[model samples]
Target: METVEFYNGNKMPVVGLGTFRVENNDDCKEAVKHAIINGYRSIDTAMIYDNESKVGEGIAEGLAEAGIARNELFITSKLWLADYGRENVQAAYETSLKKLGLDYLDLYLMHWPGLDEAVMIDTWQGMEDLYKDDKVKNIGVSNFTVSHLEALLAQVSIKPVINQVEFHPYLVQDELRRYLEVQNIVAESWSPLMNAQILDDEVVKAVAEEVGKTPAQVIIRWNIENNVVVIPKSITPSRIDENLDVFNFSLTTAQIEKLNALNEDKRIGPNPDEFSGQ
Candidate 1:
């Protein structure tokens, strides 16, 4: 698998498995196991998803069966909105670590910017503490816009190493991507396929057909081509395998431009600025 290096010299797999709505413990466990068995080196989960234990179970099982060691896998989880303070954040990570059955995380992210500036600042402090304490290998944020990042960077002693956000052909987030690039922070795409909406786009479909690849493959390739990490969720074994099959083909410059032209600022998830949590 291709990899991206964090500013702190940690390596992350360029592609990973995302566990979002696989709410069932058994299913999430199986999905993680199957994904790892199929050659995925990275796994992405979050506290809000409520399946870290199952993901951990699957990781253990997959590693055992695949004959891979613990350090060979990259695992990630996020701090939820409710855990947005220095006091709550550390405990929240501990809860996820216990649930995931791990000593340390490869990456931990602030799940959303939410509505509290002070709380978010405190959360970053917690993240910095976690990193400094060797509880997590790298730290990042999700759904953070340029404004949010600027605010965080202003007060942070350790800059975020990644920004996982809802990015796809329809919501390219060009300016934010540029900012992250200039700062040497990697951009990770959570909804790289836009909840499968891009599968129906004429441009995506045409490119997929021309390359003899699935629309999902085309989209994933587009993300990789743009130098971004992507975690596409799939519970089905075949789709999980298909998502990682992009390494076999490459998208031409014109085809990539065609897909880039599909940006409409559409988003299938909630806006980070307005989300205040339930």
Candidate 2:
């Protein structure tokens, strides 16, 4: 698996399994285990997803079966909106850690920017504490815009290594991407397939046909070429394996342009500015 290195010199797999709405414990566990056994090295989940224990179970089973150590994988989880205060942050991290059956996390992110600047700063300070104390290998944020990031940056002692957001051909977020590159922050794509809505678009389909790969593969490759870390969610074993089968092919310049041209600034997820923990 290819990795994108953080400014801190830590590496994360560019492709990983996302467990967002996979609420069924049994199914979620199986999918995680299957992903690891199939060569995946990163796994993303969040407190809001409510499946950390099952993910932990799958992690243990997968590690034992795959003969890989715990440190060989990159596991990520987020601090939910309800856990936004400085005081709440430590307990939240510990709760997530205990539930996941792990001593430390590879990456921990503030799930959303929420509505209050003071609260966001307080929450981030807590995350900075975690990083300084060696409780987590890296720290980042999700659903953060340039304005939100600027505000946070003004008060933070440790800069976020990543800003994970909804990214795809339609919602290219060109300005934000440029800003992140300037700030040396990695961009991670949540809902990279736009929840499967973009799979059948004419341009995506055409590219898939030309490359002789599935539409899903075409979109994943598009994200890869754009230097975005994509975590495409899937509970099906075959889809999980197929999602990782994107490293071999490279999209041509014209093909990449066609995909980039599909950008309509469309967003399938909530706007970070207005979300306010809704």
Candidate 3:
């Protein structure tokens, strides 16, 4: 699997398994195990997802089945909006660790920058403390706008290593991407395939046909070509394997620009600035 290094020098696989709506415990567990068995080393989960225990089970099963040590896997979990206080954030991390059945996470992210800027700042300080205390390998934020990042950066003692957001051909987020680039922070894409909706886009379809690949593969490769981390979720074994098969072909600069021009700044998920703790 291809990898990228965090600001702290920790290596993370560029492509990971995203566990968002894999709600059934057994299904999520099996999906994670299958993903690991098929060579995936990175797994992304969150507190709000409420499947950390199942993910933990899958990790244990995958480790045993693959005969790989725990340290070889890059596991990530997020802190939810309700758990934004300094002390509450630590408790949230502990809860996730317990559910994940791990001593420390490879990456821990703030799920959202709540409406209150002060709360978000406090939550980040708590995350910084966790990193200093060796509870997590790297710290980051999700769904943060450029303005939010600028404010947070002004108050932070430790800069975030990443800013994960809804990224794809349609919602490219160029401004945020540029800011992250200047800050030396990596941009991670949560819905690289636009929840599988991009598979039918004319641009994606044409590129897939020209490249002799699936639309999913083309989209995933687009993220790779742009140096962005991608996590495409799937519980089906074949689809999981297909998502990981994006390393063979490369897109040309012109083709990449063609894909880049398809951006509309559209979003299928909730906006961070107005989220009300869902």
Candidate 4:
């Protein structure tokens, strides 16, 4: 229900539904629809996720059922590594748009920072063109390191409004977060719950008990308290609803410190610098 404003003056819901591995078309569609009907206004998907059509289907159903207009929801998708060239970027964007059955995306991100800086630059330029032409509401990068951002920032004409990454209690990404803050770019967390692995942490459990909330809620609140955008994915209707029930409670300063202390500089996803996109 809370929103974060981009430098461009567009607002994004602080919490969203992430469709990373929700491969079952029926389940993905249902999850998206359910999330929207239950008060979620943001949805995150990607080209590599291969469920854009289903997501599009869900969005249509959710809008019609919820009685909300297309502008009421924020939809995001990504550009894959294979489509990382100036010549290929527009076609890739078009393909994603066609699949999603939407004329434009709320946010379009570079899925990864690929191995070559030149390719990244070219792809970003293509995205910049899309932004200029009103093809996408905003542009950003995912799984990008500070060094990668430095490279992209030095060469690009348009600055990215956000950097989506694998962020959670164990993977806080302090340096990258600081840089993004300085650059006035928002930070979005992909695996905010660490695929539900963080639910069993002792600290998370303690906080959940104290706050009378679920561990998932505790972790989500932590992200919110830190001003990080979180997208916790779920197909189960109950869990999906539970994930969004984080706005009511506030984590005490000490509890937030405890959660922050759990950071080990760990990562569950591929490292951007070394990932070959295979």
Q: List the residue pairs that clash in candidate 1.
A: none
Per-residue C-alpha lDDT of model 4 across residues 114-149, encoded as one tens digit per residue? 998898899999999999988899999998899999
lDDT of each: 0.92, 0.94, 0.93, 0.93
Highest lDDT against the true fold, candidate: 2
What TM-score goes with each of the models?
0.98, 0.99, 0.98, 0.99
In terms of TM-score, how similar is model 3 to the real structure? 0.98
Instruction: Report the lDDT tens digits of candidate 1 across residue range 1-278.
Output: 89999888989999999998888578889999999998999999999888999999999999999999999999999999988888787899999999999998999999998888888988899999998998788999998999999999999899999999999999999999999999999999988878777789888899999999999999999999999999999999999999999998999999999988988998899999899887
Q: Cα RMSD to native, each candidate?
A: 0.8, 0.7, 0.8, 0.7
TM-score of 4: 0.99
lDDT of 4: 0.93
Higher-lDDT candidate among 2 and 3? 2
Flag regions of model 4 displaced more than 4 Å. none
User: Candidate 4: deviation at residue 188, Å?
Assistant: 0.3
Q: Specify the poorest-scoring 10-residue window by lDDT in model 2.
A: 269-278
Clashes in candidate 4: how many?
A: 0
Lowest lDDT sum, 10 consecutive residues, model 3, at 1-10
Colliding pairs, model 2: none
Candidate 2 local lDDT, 86-202, one digit each (tens)? 888889999999999999999999999998999999999999988898989999999999999999888888999999999999999999999999999999999999999999899
